[model samples]
Target: MFSRAIAFIAAIGIVLTVNKPVISQNHSEHHSVPSPSETSAERESSRLTESHVNEGLTKLHQKNYSGAIESFGKAVEIQPSHYLAFTYRADIHRLLKNYQAAIDDYTKAIEFNPAHSYLRNSRGVSYAALGDYQNAIEDYTQAISIYPEEGAGYRHRGAAYYQLGENEKAMADLNSAISRNQKDAEAYTIRGEIYTNLKNPDLAIADYQQAAKLFLTQSNREGYTKAINLAKSLQQQSIVPDSK
Candidate 1:
């Protein structure tokens, strides 16, 4: 059960940050003003792009994943530099288990918005899903470098390290993640597994207890149940005599 829970978390626990659309304003004060015709054309393009984006979002909310991808693709066609459209398409691709396609789209998004840490993190998740932990680590590292204050990057990188059998590195990264966000139930859960692997059942149980509490607070019944059960199982094992 514990192993299955770990796999479940690994498969679905990757966080994707959605950015709201920002209204574009004229920046003539800082840069040379465009010709009236150019400005008008730009406005038309922006309007079309926004229309497609809205349509895509509506389709996404309806669970019409393929329709949403089509709409987002149109937005990209209308505005090749529309990173958000690429991101939306990539998210759908990832949901469909098309990891390589998701990675490609995410790479395009990152190329247009290099400073967006969440984009890198999302790309890393796709890479990890494809079992390319090395590439995943690189993307996660870039995300951490872009926004070291965010715990998601550290948490993800820690999980990748854990998969690579680098428990010490995983522990360090998970510690960093929990330090930044004590309410991070996922981090606690992963850390608990690390402790269990290291033969520290006491610490593992403590972490699981904390994780269970956090998960319950977050209304994640599945996570809470898994954590609490793991803690109880460990407790029972600890009380039993060694077979030797």
Candidate 2:
């Protein structure tokens, strides 16, 4: 349930970036032609790896976090350098509430291919889970630098800032996120919190109202209740004085 709450606040917690595979330096340039026996072994290994990866993904889709993790673990063992496998396994770990293991897998993925924006974002989120706002911001910043057009990186970084008590920075990033995607209810909620912290009750109420409206339109009763309660609480606190 808490995982769902965090999922609502952030868009899947990590971005997946496509990156090239890393072959070991031991791969010889003057390699001899593989024998039929060697080819058979390689094919078997590849088949096993594919089977495990597919099983892992299927389990994940079914919300079987533990099963997914186990399958993914087998895939990683078959091919230790599989960057995508590590990234995927990390996602499963997050779903399972194993934040540290998620971070470790993300790190391995990064080592295999450092240029992946999605992996950076995933690692940043793991760091955020451990209350390492500085590291999380760094990862988010790198992700944004790699793909500025994607709103997810900025949104994640804003969350990191919010966690760090840097409300101004958080607002700046959240505003960018909303500008990129106006229908982002999560952005509105975060911006609302920033406004509330700034003592701008009117603006906070307005944002919360927007969020509530969106939630209602989407038939999201829980989200609507959250936003509505926030707005009501702000009003009760007398965010605005009587003009009279």
Could you say which candidate leads in lDDT?
A: 1
Q: Flag regions of model 2 displaced more than 4 Å.
A: 1-38, 218-220, 239-244
lDDT of 2 at 219: 74
lDDT of 2: 0.75
Compute each candidate's TM-score over C-alphas: 0.85, 0.78
Where is model 2 poorest over a 10-residue stretch in terms of lDDT? 21-30
User: Model 1 reaches what TM-score against the true structure?
Assistant: 0.85
Please give the lDDT score for candidate 1.
Answer: 0.81
Candidate 1 stretches greater than 4 Å from native = 1-39
Look at candidate 2 and give me any clashing residue pairs.
none
Alpha carbon deviation, residue 17, candidate 1 (Å): 7.6
Residue 108 displacement (Å), model 1 = 0.6
Please report how far candidate 1 places residue 112 from its true position, in Å: 0.1
In order, what lDDT does every prediction score?
A: 0.81, 0.75
